[model samples]
Structure formats: C-alpha cells, structure tokens
Target: MMSKSTPLAALAFALSATTALAGDPVTYQLDWLPGGDKAPIYVCVDQGFCADAGLDVTIASGRGSSDAISRLAAGSSDIGMADIGALMAAKAQEGVGVTSVLSVFNKGPHAFYTVKDSGFDSVADVKGKKIATSPFTSSNVYLPLVLQDVGLTEADLELTKADAGALGPMLMTGQVDGIVAWMTDLSRYTGQGKDAGKEIIALPWSAAGLELYSAALNANDAFLAERPEVAARFVAAFKKSIEFCQTNPEEAAQSVVNMVPELEHGDVLGSLNDMLGLVFNDVTEEDGLGVFEPGRLAATWTRVAAAQGLDESAHGAEDFVTRSFQPGGEG
Candidate 1:
C-alpha cells in the first residue's frame, strides 16, 4: 500500500543523501609531525571549520617542508603547510608545481637557545662560542647569513651537527654554548633548562634582521586549476581556523589532541602557545592574516637565494606564490 508518510520519508532520505555528498574531499599534507605548530589544520577538521566549508579533509604527515612540497608537486596533496623559503628554492631549482597561497609564519623562526648566565646575551654574544645544530635542519643553510647579519662569520664560531633530540641536553650540560633551533622550541628548551638548574634565553634571527617569511599554506597547481572553488573554500576555512586558534588556544590545543590522541593535551597546548607569536606578530599586524605582502615576499626570496646559492635573477618572487586563492582575491 502507498502511504503519504512514505513519500515524506523518501524526500527526507533524498535531502540527507544530498547533504552527505556536498562535502568535497581534500587531502592536507603536513610539513612535519602533528604538534601545536600544526594546530590550525587540526582545528579546521575537529572544530567543524572544514565541514562548514563543505570539505572532507584528510591529513597526511610529512618528514619536512621538502617532503610536503614534493607531495603537493606530485598532486598527492591538494594543499599543505610548508616553509615558503623551501618552496622558493625548489621553484628556482626544479620548477616544482606547487604555489604558496597564504603566509603562516610571516617571520623566520630561526633562533639560538642558550642557558641563562652563559654570557650569550644576544646573537652577537655567540662570537667564538660553540654552537650545536641538527644536520638536516634548513636553518643550517641560513646560519651563514644570520652570522653575517650579526657582524660575524662561520669562522668566528665552532659549529657541530648533532641529532635534533640531543640539542637541549647538550645545552643544559654545557657541552655547547648554544644550540641552533627554532623559536617554537622555546618552552621545551626552557623546561629542560629549569630541570638542569638553569634558565633558557632565545635570540631570534628576526630580532637581528632576518626579515623573511617562514611557514605558509601551499597548494598543488593542478588542484587549483581543476577545482578552483574547492581550493578557495579551503583557504578561507584555513584562515578561519587560524583565527580560531588565536582566540581560543585551549580549545585549539584540544582539537589537535582529539585527532592525534597519542599527543598529550598539555604538551600540545604549550607548543601551540609558544607558536602563536611566530604566527601573529608585528608583520601580521601590518599585513592582515593570510596575506603575502609583496615587499616581504621579495625579501624572503632574496634571503632564500642567498642561503641556497641560487641565482636571484632566475625567477621573480611572484613565481613561487599565487594570491588568487585568498579571500577577496580573483578566484
């Protein structure tokens, strides 16, 4: 028998099916393992920002910026976070098919961490001191430029490469006068220093004239060409996620922990709080969130070229980035 309620039920089922199929699938690649620095993407998924934007996002972990870029270049990831400097270098060297769409960390994160009372008050104070760094960190390439900025050179200090996990222990035990690390590790190193009965001090390269962009949102060229609307929606949603993290840090931290249950909530919160400064600061205040200011973009390419020994004239800064995906942009 045909009943009136059967038609209503069929209509409701059709609407539900339509709503379920509305979300576009997206693969998000990470430049590094899941952590507080990588919270915005997690927030986007966990806090419904991606869902609200009609995206079904899946995050893929990466070993580093280069790996993340490689995935994007190969079209394995639709969008991801990576160091824009790495992208600039890659574009000049190989013409990788990835374009940075938005700035994440507008300032460089390179810094020197020293135990307080070590007489290393500033970048200049590291002269003739022993510095330990990870062999594979991109910071190594920029070390020469940072040293030159402080009126010093590689010859002025003794440099040693060590495993990344050992850097803090080396500094606490006085094995090295300082360790070359990112500002994102400030809290971790500070806690290590306290346990060793010492205080930690960070000398950021940005404070000493390393005016350049760092981490940024990058998208695959093919993805942007084929699904322009999806790319734009993802970028807008990502910007919203960043804003949400800035306002509700604890909630943001929980979002990451919720997705990556192996990560402790406290550690994620601390790392996220430590990373906020790198994301939102003087540069971000001048240029609104997610913008790649032309002057800073040029400055970033200059620094990258100098660090990687690439010819500056090979490509313009615009070659590595596309602004059309941003809110109010041509897309």
Candidate 2:
C-alpha cells in the first residue's frame, strides 16, 4: 500500500493544481523600460491582480510606443501600453491591427525642463534661448505647435538634438537653457538639478494649450476577437491595479522594484509619485478614470493630424479605439 502523504506534500500538490487551473496566459508589452511610470503592470503581476482575474501575464520590454504597437499588431502581445497619439498616427498611416482600450494618461506628458535661474519660467520665455532635446522624442513633432501658441516659432530659438541621457547635464551646466522631456522624468531631472546646485522647473505644454492624450492600454485585434472574455477580465484587473497604485503608492513602487531588482526603491518611489499626477488629475476627475470622452478623442486626433501632416478627414479618432473591453463596457 502507498504511504499516507505528509502535510507539506499534500499542500504542495494542492497549490500546484490550483496554479495549473489558475488562468489563461496573456502577454503584456511595455512602451519603454521598467520604471515607476510603468508600475501598474508590475503591480498587477506582483500583487496577484492578474491571477485573480484569471490571467497569467508575461511582460515584454519595449523600446518605444511604436515598438510596443508593432508587437501588439503582430499578435505577440495581448495588451500593453503605448502613446495614444502614436496609435492615431499609425492607424492613420498604416491601419495597424491594434486598438487602444483604456486611456492611461488623459493629458500629454510633454514638457520643457529648465533651471530656475535661467529666466525661462514658461514656454513663452524660451523664444530666444538655446534648447536641447533628444532627436527621437515625439515631443519634437509638437514643439512647433506649442511655440506657435506662445507666439514664437522654431526659428526664434536655437535648437540642438542630443542624447536623452545628456539633456539634464547640458541644462545644469548651462550648455542649453532648457531641455524637452516627458513629465514622467521630472523627479529624476529635479534630483539631478539638486545635485548640480540648481532648481529645476517644468513647463507643461498642457498648461500652454497643448491638450491631448498620451499613454494608453492597447490590445491586438486577434487577441480581442479570439478571446474577448479574457480581454475584458484583463482590463478590469488592470483598472483595479491603477486604483491600487493610487491608494498605496509605496507598495506600488515596491512592486516595480520587486519585479526589477536593478531599480532602486527610492528612485522608483519618487518617479511613481511624480507619475501619479499624469494618471489621476483634473482630467480624470472630470471624465472618470479610463473613459475616453468623445470630444477629447477627436481633439487628440486633430492634434495628431496637424503634427504629422495627415489628412484629418481620412480617419476618425474612434477608429483607433475599442472601448468594449473597458471595465463596464459592452464586452
């Protein structure tokens, strides 16, 4: 006769069986490297949110919004984050097989970083100053529109493109009066400025009338069509993760550090705190979280069309979004 199993062996077998029947496997793609700005996905996995929603999620690193969108369009990832503006541009140009499901950042992340002593307190003050930016940033495309709103143009300022890593240093050393970067990096840049004995100020283009959506959760068409239930569950869980992050920011930051050990805890926490404003702010308060109001969506497409020189009438903004997968959506 077989001997009775020990308590430990019995518990192990039960846990294994539970995991085996836990959930369907889903792949998540990131628009950029692992950081506090990308904390929600990490929180979902590390905090059992995905598992609770019957999803076994695997995260894939992405180089940028374009890269992430491409991966989703190719069916390599079920859902992930990307810039909604980039999605609009790609859909207008190529008609990619992906659609944004949830708006993560309701407002644009584009901003100008300057040292306080540089006398550049707002976008209007940079007309005659020297500016440095990363050549690859999408912000460069909208710079002219923002400048136009401020009654200036690119010709009014001296612009230089440099590596993203060098932007903070260049500004602190007075090599450039300001640098263009995302609001997500405000904490890191401010810390660097403190190290250099300078005070950093961020001039958000949104305040200067550059209004539009930024990052959002997007899904592959095939994934949504084949397993609509799974998509709905993931979106619901993802929404819960964002709410959790807002209530427990330190824990959310720790979730990223838990998944990516190379990141420092304090740095992750600081960046996560800075990013919360982008996720939950006046826009969120007005329109509710994750809902893409029709007026704002159209405005986003309008800005994108102008920036990329695409025909505004060629495609409607709704073409790039599939709202049925939202938490209380039709799906």
Candidate 3:
C-alpha cells in the first residue's frame, strides 16, 4: 500500500461525504401562488438568504392546507408554508408530526364581509343570518370563542361554506348576506372590476380573542430531527429576510412580483403596505419578525379543537407547535 497516498486518499473521501451532507437539498411548498403575503420568502430567495443558510429552497404553489399538510406528513415535502390552523387540523385528523418554525404573517388575516347597509353592525347582528366561510380556517373554528366575546354563538347564525375566491363577489352582490375570509384587499377584487364599491368590514383576529398565528414556516418532525443545524440556519436566514423586506419594501414587492407574474398587477405594495400595518404589529417590531407566541398558538388550537367538535388531551398537544428552534433564532 502506497505510504504517503493513503492519508490524502482518506481526506478526499471524508471531504466528499461532508460536502454531500452540507449540500442536502430541501423543498418548501407555498400555501398558494407566490405573492405579496409571501413577499419576504421570495425576497429571501432573490437576496440569497437560503443559499447563505446552506439550503437549496424551492417554493411551489399549494392546493390548500390539507394538501400541503398531507405532502409534508408523507415526506413528499421537506418544508411547508402554512398556517397554524393547517398544522392543528392535520394533528387532529391524522396525528401527524409537523412543526412550525417562523411565522411570516404574525397577524391572522381572517375576517367577515357584510354590505355597509346590511344593518349587521356587530357579531350579535349576525344572529339568524346566513354567513359563509371555509371550514378549513381558524376563523370558522374559533367563531364561537370570538362570538362569545362579542355576545354571539354558533346557534345564533346559519353557517354555510362559500367556495373559495367566490366569496367576495357573493358578498358584494348580496347573494349570501355576508362572507368570511381575509378582510380582502378591496383593491384586489375591485381591480378585476367584479366587485366595484364593495367594502369589507375588518374584524381582526386580535380584537376577537382569536390571536392565533397565521402563515408560518413549517417542516415535519423527521426532517428537524435529522438536520437541526440546517433547520437553525433556515430559521435565521428567514428572520434576516424579514428585516430586509421591512427596510426595503419596494425591492421586496418587486421580488414577489417576479415570483408570481399575476401578482404584478395585484397591487402588491398597496395591499402589502396595508397588511403590513396589521402584521408588523407591535410584538413583531419588538421581538424579531417571524417569532412564535405560544399563548396565541394555544388560543388558536382551542378554537380549532372546538371547530372539529373534539377536545384533545395528552401528549399529542405537542403536535401543534414547538419552540426548540425559536429561542436562539435571530428573532
């Protein structure tokens, strides 16, 4: 056996293995087509945050939370961009192992829309009236908790599931009376000329005792266990990306537009600027962006549990969220 060559041969083999481990690729599924709400993530990619984190991150459009969760739990996806509600739902239905790392949109963007002249002034006014919503959201789940605070309950209203993206027009036309969804950017739907003069009455989750997190960076348990250092890097870079977006809104908006051409005309900046007012909020500005609040997560889970018509007990509660990656994060 050649003497001097032996040492060098071993070193080359070791380096190859090290590089392979370091270069492990990871893919993340976005909850919808990329756009303003997903701006920071696209900005992160454009600005090389993921690369700096030693991750080759891929963002793709998602069918919905259930699909996103299914892929993530099945290991078809290494990471997912989803809301706490999705995570809670998957845990409730299948006992899947998923965890949320960073929250992109700190404020829950769900709300109900009623015609300005409907005479439905408050939550109580919704009583005995038809209200439309998607059962998949925290808004549907926590209606009771919030209505309780507003002096209303499930018995007070007739609930219905309005097809997604069809609610805005349905509300503006007075077909269903009221529609529940994001306090949609009026500019978004009206820009399409479908719902001109349509107004959305904003009922922020914070005010309604539904302070659960929305739009978080998530991954499954196995991925986290196998590569924690990699996970930490991703979390850190994502946090840095948020700071960059806040400091440079124009650049951030453009980055997201590039990721989704349809959003170029969606009034990204104006809408994001408004959503930012609701999302950046006081807690985010003070505690780094994307940081999770356990109390809020718990509150959201409670509503989700009530919505599914079952109360969770025992160890599975950990399935909702985890703080292991947050404490040392840049946030």
The candidate that wins on TM-score is 1
List the candidate 1 regions with Cα displacement exceeding 4 Å.
Answer: 1-22
Q: Candidate 1 residues 95-199, lDDT tens each?
A: 899999988998889999997777899998989999999999989989999889989999999999999999999999999999999988888898898899999
Single out the weakest 10-residue window by summed lDDT for candidate 1. 322-331
What TM-score would you give candidate 3 relative to the actual structure?
Answer: 0.80
Instruction: Predict model 1's lDDT versus the native.
Output: 0.92
lDDT of each model, Cα atoms only?
A: 0.92, 0.92, 0.70
lDDT of 3: 0.70
Pairs clashing within candidate 3: none
Root-mean-square deviation of candidate 2: 3.4
- Candidate 3 lowest-lDDT run of ten: 186-195
* Model 2 misplaced regions, further than 4 Å: 1-20
260-306: candidate 2 lDDT, tens digit per residue: 99999989988888888988999999988998888999999999999
Which of the two, 1 or 3, has more TM-score?
1
TM-score of 1: 0.94
